[model samples]
Target: MKKIIITLSIALSFALPSYAFADQAACEAKAVSKDGKPLYGAAKDASIKKCMGDAKPNDCEAKAVSKDGKPLYGAAKTASIKKCEGGK
Candidate 1:
């Protein structure tokens, strides 16, 4: 029992910090990319949230004046909001 408890504690000690750091980093990256723009992250997964948000998923114009931008074209807009993963 003591050994189990110790092992669990040790595992949590390492896992918790890494998890926290990853989330923070994801948020930081999103903020940097936003660059005055706005975005949200997945409440559950920092990476998933970051990926979709970074993709800039919707309504973004390719040319604004005369071009059709696709999803992968990047830059989230109204239509792209759906691509936000969790829609944060």
Candidate 2:
């Protein structure tokens, strides 16, 4: 059991870095404009931020739910809709 645990731990350590690199590549792929040009510098950063942020739900009404699983109400719901729509 001890030897199996150590081998699995070593294998996971090597696998994790590759997963991180793949995620970075995926983020870069998503950081392009609608015209197919890749964004760079501040543009790339902003694009990535918007891309990742919008991954949750594209619709404003869908994003009005709180992190705790409760639906937002009143000003909170309105604010969420505005922010989600503006990001697009």
Candidate 3:
């Protein structure tokens, strides 16, 4: 039982880093420009950052709902989205 547990733990440790790398790779693939060219420099960095933030299924904007379940608007929505997305 102990051996099985140790093996599973090892496997999970290896798998988790690859999962994060996959997200990064996918985000990088999307870092293109409006002219159909790949972005470079600060633009590429910013694009990848935004893309990674949106890779999650329930992203910050989607979670910016009011207490009554209605979608938030204006400054309220901005704050909610920022908080939900790790205050970025």
- lDDT ranking of the models: 3, 2, 1
- TM for candidate 1 is 0.36
TM-score of 3: 0.62
From the highest TM-score down, the ranking of the candidates is: 3, 2, 1
- Give the clashing pairs for model 1: 56-75, 56-76, 57-80, 58-80
* Top-lDDT candidate index: 3
Write model 2 residue lDDT over 1-88, tens digit each, in one string. 9999999999999999998678777887988878999988999988766655554454778778999989999999878887777754
Stretches of candidate 2 above 4 Å error? 50-88
Winner of 2 and 3 under lDDT: 3
Clashing pairs in 3: none
lDDT by residue (tens digit), candidate 1, 1-88: 9999999999999999898778777765655333554445543355455554544423333322223544332343433444343454
Lowest lDDT sum, 10 consecutive residues, model 3, at 52-61
Instruction: Please give, for residues 1-88, the per-residue lDDT of candidate 3 as tens digits.
Output: 9999999999999999999899999988999988889989999999988877754536777888889999999999888877876665
* Candidate 2 clash pair list: none
